[model samples]
Target: MGRSRPGPIRWLWYAVGGRLPDEYREWVLYDLTAPTWVLRHLCRAMVQHSVWLLLLLLPIPLTLRIWMVVTGVSVGLFFSLAFIEDASERRLIRQGFPVGLNRKIREESSGAQRSELAAMYAAYYTTEPDV
Candidate 1:
């Protein structure tokens, strides 16, 4: 069966670290485990940063405000990407998933690619003694 998704308002709340309803739990797992999960997470981070950017409406010059917003978003995205695993895991936990479940799901989903890479690494990097 297809998973149920949250509405826009619920999604906005979810993007800001709010827990989703039980009906959306399966969708949340799929979202975090899908191949495009990293991109999805980054997109959510952008949404979060954009919301915070709204606070930059001060008496400052337009160029200065723009520069500050840009800088803030850049830093936020960098940190978000840096800590993506932790963030995603925390999100999963908030939705009633166990710790490390995200990693487990990702690893399982990418098993074929991982095995292929491991084979390539063994062939290219492992040294064998002369027979």
Candidate 2:
């Protein structure tokens, strides 16, 4: 667990959007190399179903064309989020990124993050006044 940027609500925002935040992205996607389609689909379903159900249950009757369009878009968004990580990795490999690049980046960013927090706390909580 590290300090959240701006705030922690961003974690929920990224999870709902099917995108991991920067702090979590490298660990989940690269270090663990976790397959996330199932999880992302579950998240997408929660949002998509709520939206589609609202449309389906609307008092105004919808034409077949409108219904089809909504269904098509919902499916497309679900599929895209489900496979986004796999697609991103494939693209990175194609671009010739090193296999351990994520690990290296994580280490550098972690150290910088810690130091920044340390400096901030030191400044804010320091009891001794400057001469």
Candidate 3:
């Protein structure tokens, strides 16, 4: 998917109905390619579980006083996506991607890009250090 080369606004795309904001690109890629096993699970959760945000709208119409639950979930999601992106950098640290790999990708340098298969191979070999 990343090989298709997204634009500057690569956050998401559209689907059926109104055709808006249902398909996620970068988030999906991150979830799939997360450097650590923990990060992969975490990123997947952030992308897949965002539908819970709609519960806030339900509480208002249902006369449910869910302010605390709503507020906490709101804050959690607000930080979760950004946290996942930050955590993706650990891939570089774990696989020993040379310095500035993140910058290279952000710069859209084709030469700096690794094939998805190669990345998957590296991820397969990554193991947590014994503490």
Candidate 4:
């Protein structure tokens, strides 16, 4: 969560777990390579923080308050992003997540059949200038 200020070590942990080896290099590649597990980890953190807020907030030491706040903020932000991502996925479904659909189709189709379909589409489209 952008609003949550994690300590350097925690930040590094997230970076590493997310498969972002370097902060400054190939940002897109890092994102593409990011593990879905990291998101799940964040979700777990969010839930853990909520439980802390409910069960430990009043009893924890002041020194621990910072952690509680950061975790709580991070949880809120993570859920927000999750919602946004879900919305985007739904939108992609409507407008077409072609790459995703293609992957599914490829996985389900025989290689020879897939190749034949590809060839047919290529041949048909190549002849149609409007296409």
Candidate 5:
């Protein structure tokens, strides 16, 4: 079946932890499993934290508002990174995928690159003793 994306409004909701309709299940799978999934996750986290920007509407000094938004986003990003795997899995689950499926799919998708890296590491880091 073809992957179907949600509309912008639906996508924003999805980005902030809301569940998408079943029609976008394939797109959600692709989103969480694609090669750049981590980056995509971080982008979603940024969007989630961007509510801090609303501080700009406050009567506070411009610099203070900017700093508050920056600090809030920075802290949010840090926590997001710390819980990225769990969060990704939860998002997948919300979309009807089983738990741990994200990690399995990621591992399977990167198997070739991972094997190549292991081979390269062994070649560079292992030494043979001369007889």
Candidate 6:
């Protein structure tokens, strides 16, 4: 029950000054020390599929080299975005986003970890003045 990416406003929220996690899985996996929770089982599943896309490229027929290359690039981009998300999360934390450190502690956690980011944003908004 989670999304695949943080929205523009969420990014903006972090960009300005908020430290809460966009996803809860990120909190448990990267922020927590034990990180035993797998609240949204699909988080790791997506990661596995992303990697599998790369591995599958090697076994295709020779005539499909172009397809393989395209597939590889797509998978690589997905991996890159995943990394970018983590990096962004770290940046948001350093910038003092609410719960930033907790988000990072979710351990390889991505967008799938958050259970109710919208509520978090609502809470965050109350603490801020309208601009």
Candidate 1 ranges with C-alpha deviation above 4 Å? 111-131
Q: State which candidate has the highest lDDT.
A: 5
TM-score for each candidate, following the candidate numbering: 0.79, 0.33, 0.33, 0.23, 0.79, 0.27
lDDT of 4 at 102: 32
* lDDT (CA) per prediction: 0.76, 0.45, 0.43, 0.41, 0.77, 0.44
lDDT of 5 by residue, 5-74 (tens): 7889998999999999876766777787777888999989989998998999999899999999899999
28-102, model 1: which lDDT tens digit per residue? 877777778899998899888996577478888988888889898999999999999999999988877667876
Location of the lowest summed lDDT over 10 successive residues in candidate 3: 13-22
Itemize residue pairs with steric clashes in candidate 1: none
lDDT tens readout by residue for model 4, 47-97: 434544553556668768767777777777667566644432332243223
RMSD values, in order shown: 12.0, 11.3, 11.8, 12.5, 12.7, 10.3
Task: Give the better candidate number (2 or 5) by TM-score.
Answer: 5
Residue runs of model 3 more than 4 Å from their true location after superposition:
1-65, 91-100, 109-131
Two-way TM-score contest, 4 vs 6, winner: 6
Report the Cα lDDT for residue 34, model 6: 27
Task: Kindly report which residue pairs in candidate 3 clash with one another.
Answer: none
Off by over 4 Å in 4: 1-29, 32-55, 59-78, 84-131
Rank by lDDT, descending?
5, 1, 2, 6, 3, 4
Q: What would the per-residue lDDT of candidate 6 be over residues 32-104, giving only the tens digit for each residue? A: 2223333222233344344435545566675576667557666755674556445444544453455554443
Model 3 has an lDDT value of 0.43
Q: After superposition, how far is residue 72 of candidate 1 from its true place, in Å?
A: 0.6
Candidate 2 local lDDT, residue 62: 75
What clash count does candidate 3 reach? 0
